[model samples]
Target: MTSEKKTYNFLIAGVPYKLKTSHDDATVEELVEFVNSRMNQALGVTKNGSYQNAAVLTAMNLAEELILLKRKAHRELEKLEEKALQLSMDLENSKSNKVLNN
Candidate 1:
């Protein structure tokens, strides 16, 4: 994230739109391309191919991806934390065992 916020104009599904974002030109371009791709996919699968329906489907797909990634990252973090705690306990036990032997 950068401190500079700018406005960008791009087309999605052949529709022109303007967006204000803190991201750079490349990021804006990538986002527009990705959205268009998703919307096109949704439209392709539908019989009527309504833009509104396509938009809803695209939004749902993106939300599902976000939630799945978040859950995976959280589970990974928990595993790392658990491993760290186990290592710390083992070190403490080793230190106590050495003291007892002495």
Candidate 2:
């Protein structure tokens, strides 16, 4: 796989940080833009005081959300796989029955 380094700038707790990650050129820019927007919103929420702590809390919340999303995605994938397997078995059984009838 081809890896390209991309730089993303975002605000965390009113402080700006640049993050560099290796990703495909096409999608990395979009990911960077999204990260910047989310960081800005989180920073805005904690503008009054203790920006650093607020940023940390925001990161924790985002991480938890990601974990839950992953779990949900895995469950959906499992269900789809089971459905596919059942379909394949049914197809095979149908073919065998047709052959027996002939």
lDDT per model vs. reference? 0.92, 0.74
Separate clash counts for every candidate:
0, 0
RMSD of each: 1.1, 3.3
In candidate 2, stretches whose alpha carbon ends up further than 4 angstroms from where it belongs are 1-10, 22-48
Taking all chains together, each candidate's TM-score versus the true structure is 0.92, 0.67
Q: Give the residue spans of candidate 1 off by over 4 A.
A: none
Worst 10 residues of 1 by lDDT: 7-16
State the lDDT of candidate 2 residue by residue for 1-102, as single tens digits.
256677766554346677787766556667656655666676667756466655676677789999999999999999999999999999999999999999
lDDT of 1 at 35: 95
State residue 80's C-alpha deviation in candidate 2, in Å.
Answer: 0.7
Q: What TM-score quantifies how close candidate 2 is to the native fold?
A: 0.67
